[model samples]
Target: MSSPTSIAPAARLSDVHVAFDGVDVVCGVDLHVAPGELAAIAGPNGAGKSTLLEVLAGTRSPRRGQRAVPGAVAFVPQRAAIPPRLPVTVRDVVAVGAWGRLGPWRRADASAHAAVARSLSRMEITELASSPYASLSGGQQQRTLLAQGLARQADLLLLDEPTTGLDADSSRRIRSVLREEADRGVAVVCVSHDAPLLEAADRVVRLEAGRVVGAPRT
Candidate 1:
């Protein structure tokens, strides 16, 4: 983890717009996330937080505006689609983060294995590294997904309602990890309704009807 020092911006969106089925989801939203900063997005249900995150992740193309995402962007969706009967272990799931950088026909190498171990340790899930991924509790599963994201060495992390299904303790643990990441020069953007979790952010942006309703402030 890098020290909490001044760093460059990891992502910037200028007049970004996104529409789904001819319905605007994000309208002319301008946002910037600097390295080592944690920015929280809060809004009512159907405020388009998830849609904006998907656009930022490059998974959903924007309808307009210039968007720049530096380095790798890791996104943990609200509900990760994990196979209920897959024969994968926790460590194996984390190693999937390296798939994008792997060569064709290549398997997990020593470096990838080491990264998986380190990510699990950082998420405090080393003890569950060998557990069947589907057998873990919801909170544990969320932690494993977070480890997968961390293993990718992502410069920008976009979490969509990560604490939705988590208990108080689990939510706190996850928020602590996110804060630690922000301190390490990783831009963190979390879309959540959790009031307590918002305190970890340096700024908060409120969205409504696919547009920013007010100036983002601390």
Candidate 2:
């Protein structure tokens, strides 16, 4: 397994704050994620866990304080926001990861396709590569999304309740996959209300009223 200490700090939020609709969502958060670390974010409903993940993923900018994130980042939202009628195959979705590196004008070459294949294989979804993404079960869809992130070679992976609504077996599989990714030097930050998931993490952060209420401990 890749050591968490092996990779430098890839993300940091110093007293960060975020607000929505005149209400504060995240309040004065001070957090850091090192590469290869499996960090879990736990909090009550409406505690801003999802908001924090979004901020780190660059989907939402912080309203205050300093935020620093480096390298490639891949985010999997709670709902897996994928189009149902996109007409793109499962493999095609995973290949989208290479788009940023390939740029808009260039096409994905052999190396990029190889990465997509490896990612699909790693997630054990190679058999579904040609299938329509919408036809897969919830677990399969989540795995496919994970494969997409892996194909991107993301140094940081921010996941928001990735295991929500999954069966116990499915959830366990997803957790195992995340552990493998962390072992491979991908920083993993997951937000979940599930206590079991928290136990598997190297460190856990708790929040209340959008403020960190407890220090993270291994």
For model 2, residues 111-167, the per-residue Cα lDDT tens digits are 888889998988888999999998989888888887888788888998888888887
Clashing pairs in 1: none
Model 2 quality (TM-score): 0.92
Off by over 4 Å in 2: 1-7
Cα lDDT tens digits for candidate 1, 139-170 = 98888888888887789999988898787777
TM-score of every model versus the real structure: 0.91, 0.92
What's every prediction's RMSD, in angstroms? 2.6, 2.0
Candidate 2 lDDT (Cα, whole model)? 0.84
Model 1 Cα RMSD, Å? 2.6
